[model samples]
Target chain A: MDKYILGKYVPLNTFIHRLDPRMKILSMILLMVAIFMPFPSWTFTFVMSGFNALIIFVLMLISKVRLRDIIIQLRSIWFLLLVLMIINIFLPPNGSIHIIAQSGNFKLYAESFMQTGKVMLRLIEMFGVAMILTATTSPQELTFGFGWFIKPLKKIKFPVEEVSMTVSIALRFIPTLIEETNRIYKAQSSRGVDFKHGNLKMKFKGLIALIIPLFVSAFTMSDDLAFALEARGYNPKAERTSYRVLKWSTKDTIWIILITLFAAGIITISAMHLDLLRHFFPKIW
Target chain B: MQIEFKNLYFNYNNNSEFKVTVLKNINYLINKNNITAIVGKTGSGKSTLTELINYFLKPTSGQVITDGFISENSTKLKFKVVNKLRKKIGYLFQFSENQLFEDTVIKDVSFGVKNFYPKDDGYEQKSKEALRLVGLDESFDSRSPFDLSGGEKKRVAIAGVIAYKPDLLILDEPTAGLDAQGKKEIMDLFKKIHETGVQIILITHDMNVVLEYADEMIVLDNGSIQKYGSPKEILKENVEKYNLETPHIYKTINALKEKGIVLNNVTDIPSLVTELKKHG
Candidate 1:
């Protein structure tokens, strides 16, 4: 369970890794918005989502994160995507524009198939976007970037510093907590607590044994941490120094320019679509 | 029951980049009816070795033939097979008290019994019997396991495993984190349990525990065995070469021998006192 690298930050020296985390965070938000831009034309929406999927793949490669690793990470969510596509393809609640296959009461539509493809592409792009952002940006960087991005919210007493500290601390303890849980799980399993072999009630009852210990340990750990922080004269409201401050470099500016151009292209294409792809590629069609 | 490891090789996260071999080419036959100790430094695959016997971890390439069940990476060790193995072999993890979860001592102790044999109606009886064996009486039964002293909580955890009455018990650092009194009591409890004819496999860093309790010992330096023989043989021969800690008793005996007062190797302080009186 600890070996799952999908959401983990992989430290690598790459072009994307060196980009300002705040810029990366900003681009992530922008790209996510672009992915779900809700264009009036379905063709433009479908095609643009496909294009975004390609962009994610290219970005992953450029960031030095292996395509294979990303695909392996995506495999865990493949079932959900499959279920969605299957329902969209075979059990669409409404009429089909082009019914390609039909049984007595069931029909398969080309339009619904296209719709399923669109859904799959959108989901894949979103997952990819998250993967790229997390894999490139370290947890510390992400926390700092998030805090910086939401700094304006502090004007309304939103406690951005506490939020960032909480994020950083949580990220730090994930590994430690994972190791503890594994130990408890193995210990319980040795005593014949089969977590995999039980009804919901039975499983929950079995889990109570582990949950109590985990809660106790977590409280103990947090208490110690708080004690240590206090002993060291740490304060949330007091301004703290950073070890690695985020700087807006020329690379960050170049990424912003690229993001602007991409956004502009998407806006322009979404504004004017009528049989666009086939119109451009009649021979291929 | 017999455990035979034939060319056993084990690794962690085999499909991931973090994959590293933990145990390599382990071959041994563990005959029944005696306590066998596995002594090794931290990360020397001591716990991992015990984990294999319990089928908590399986070998990458070789067979772990325990009580006639074979585990290897080439074939999937089925759940039913592993469940049967677990029933026959009880494992006491280090700091086992952390596993206590039930509100009452009896409930906590009976957790394993009830978990494995839900159909059995006499789990409370077995749990009570286990608690008695571990030196906890009926007075402590209804109290919350959480509120118990450290030693009492550890016993409750030990009782959880003992309630099932496993034929083979595997203890990983059973004496860890206990006071001297708690340690002796817990060790004595194991001795009493051992007298009942259940074979035991102990993983301990304390050489005194091995010298006093273990009939045979496997001195592990890394993933490989430095010496696999009686504790006496290992202590006499390769122990110093492997840099294993000489037990306090062994150190005292050695110091006496240097003063030209040679005596029989007594494992514990009480035995050494008796041996000294006999010679005097």
Candidate 2:
């Protein structure tokens, strides 16, 4: 459970931490867009992955958050990465030729293997960027940044404040829900629900034992929290003033410039007619 | 089952640099069939102590010796054996009402019984009997646990444990948040449960509950055992020292004794009033 480090902000007095969260959020979106900007070739994918990793390493150094902690946070998603790799492994290349057994059509192309690695690397890069954003930004700042970004939508009568409040509450309750689920699971285990044992059917039964209680308690907690919020004069429509404002610093300006340049570079690369940037599905024989 | 702690130390977030030691060098023997009440202020390791009983928490340094097993770290125990051990000890968590999950009261109570003894034919009857033991009759069995009052929900949660019929029953602040009558009813139910030869360990701040029901008392201060003795002796000697409020009867009795009245030490209100009558 400690491995599941979602949105756990690490307080540090480093350059990355000091950057405005709005800039951080904008940079994260830009980086994500660049990462998902489909690579034209396997070589480009590998090159982009290396570039992403290098950028993440630099961010880690500037943030002063331990690389070990980031790795631990990444461990929770390793299974998903493995599954993606496994799925890619069995798929035949676009123009596959017979490698070992032509009768069974079992063709193994070197390009396909590289393609699998490329996809896995892309996923890792995405997760790495997400982890950085969550680790660097506190929940309040993250939500505030989100609200600020979406502030333009309020012109269309979009109820942006209510939307941001919902998102913030949902984000805040994720860890709380996880904790509550853990408690209910333990309580059920104490009552002889052998969650660690039994076949698949029995395990599902054990899960019900946990889920029912978790829902009941979650509802109760939400009720209490709603009351507390109302008591504190928290109205969604109210013009709320915050204690700490996100100031735009020089570091934010520099980071924003770098991300904008990176985005421009991605678009420029996509427009170029380089052979290395073209998709290549080599035939295997 | 006999429980013993030898030089126990417990720390939270044990692997982190910011780890904090919550309990230190705790050593005590909790004998079977006796009601032992653990009293401490908030954050004084009372809940942590109860967690140790069911092996929910492992000691940071020393051993928790229970029955035929000794555990310092939770990972050392075999998974199946841990479940079996847990089945034999009922734990009523603080604010136990939150543990109720089943749609109906009967299902909630039967949950533990069915889990521990999947093949048992008399689970429904036994669950109903457990509910009855907690003073909820069959008429309320079909009702949703969610619709019940706070005290009723707590009772159903307790019945969920009682249905399992564990040899050792550990309750954490069982009477908390209950009205006066509700508190008394729950305490009387606990006394009745103890009378059935089940060992009871209670973690509470209510000195009155401790004085009236507990045969032995353990006072905790800053995660260390400050005092352990008979309730009468511990309250008389170390109540002020431990920064605990004296029960009303004990306060009056002590006030009279301070004036050289020398009335007999009594735990309950009726007996203390009778002693005062004798003095008159």
Candidate 3:
């Protein structure tokens, strides 16, 4: 289940893999809105994970990638951020920077392990800038960068090219539904359906016998990919004209002026609540 | 039963950097209660050599032995020894009538006889005697294998892999997209489940269903094994230089052995119409 390395791509050509897929989808939606516009500020999460670790080390050295393939795509969502930081570091809250413990009636806090280690470092910097904008954009340049961000909302007529062809066929079927759920979980685990040592009611009946043949082979491959996108003449209100235009150079205006001066230096250092960068990232709170 | 495949090299991303090599440097030796077949054409590697006998793809390097169970790679076979060697290998799969998800045809032929005989006790009379051995009896058990048809959903997916009895079945293109009477009624219910001795293998491009039910053929192209033998000595030579295509009753018995008229064991079309009625 090599979990389709999340939105795959990886063809590597460098320089954030030649940017401007609408400036890497508007610098990954302004770096996931400046990593969830800070609120719990432990010196605003160590200066926003040290400016997202220098933008994940210059987008993994300009998309040559490999920091163990972005820690194997952020270790597939680290088991829901390690069960939400182990239920917020063993159930916190009644604070005063706690942990002056008494033994039996626990207490711990330290502001819930510095607020779940600053929400797991803002979820590993929003899953490493969405896996470096899907390993440097290519699914038809991320469907022409979400059809150039919904082409000016098609002048209010909307249906913006059928919502960018249903978001590029749901991001090209997330690696064809992870290779048809890894071939219907290797054809129902070659019909024995053990699915990794059962028992949770036989692993929920081997996950509904591998999700009813992965929803009957994903509704029989989306009805043969909707009759092969209606036998090719796919007219989502026609007039579609793109071969691969997107140019806007000057290195996409210096990546929109360094993501608008790093979102105005993270909203002016979270509105000046910088007690000297809280005496240098005072263990994140 | 005997499967072997020693220096077998199958590679599909052997730790990436675009690996691919799908079964090159391979070798053979199938021998165990007959049948074989395996022709080629569509990206050769005949369904990656029937998923390396039943590891469902492993050999990115070597070994696969089988009926003495060796394995060697594909993570040295575990998961209860590949579900007890997939309950003795019943494979099927290439449009195995879309691996039916069950909802009937007697719970999809007792879903692999209750996943490899879970405490037996006549698993509903062995899933209605494997749906009456693929002809589909017991009034099509409680219908709805998506309401049958395309050759009764490939005989309820070959009675759900021979109702888990498998002594080695490996099918693949079991009469793909049928219709010459659904490919002679699923090759006469796989020649009555290979006369109950089981050991089948099949995988075809249909050199007339490997000259009417192969007793060993192989062929494969790019990823190696160009000819392994005995479909009347690999369809009697110049089989279009191994791209294949001889079976039109082996080009009318090689145009009546180029007029000299020798028909020694004519392979099919009713054994070349009973050897041209002994030369009329």
| DockQ ranking from best candidate downward | 1, 2, 3
TM-scores for every candidate against the unseen true structure = 0.90, 0.89, 0.36
Cα displacement (Å) at residue A153, model 2: 0.6
- Write the residue-wise lDDT of candidate 2 on B13-68 in tens digits: 88875688899999999875799999988889988877876877888988888776
For candidate 1, give the docking quality class from DockQ.
medium
Cα lDDT of candidate 1 equals: 0.83
Candidate closest to the true structure, highest DockQ:
1
lDDT of 3 by residue, A170-216 (tens): 77777777677676677667878787786777667778777776788
Off by over 4 Å in 1: A11-15, A38-47, A64-96, A101-108, A272-279, A282-285, B236-243, B253-280
Q: Give the poorly placed runs of model 2, Cα more than 4 Å off.
A: A37-44, A64-83, A93-105, A227-235, A262-285, B238-243, B257-264
TM-score of chain B of each: 0.93, 0.95, 0.36
What are the lDDT figures for the candidates, one per model?
0.83, 0.81, 0.77
lDDT of 1 by residue, B1-280 (tens): 7999999888887876568788888999997688999988888898998898888887888999999988888767676778888999889988787878778999888888887788999999999999998889989999998788888888888899989999999999999988788788888889999999889999998887888888999877668876788887676543656657877777888889899888775766888899999889
lDDT of 2 by residue, A62-143 (tens): 7655567656755776787677656655775565443543435555556656666776666666767787888788888899
DockQ of each: 0.66, 0.60, 0.17
Error of 3 at A20 (Å): 24
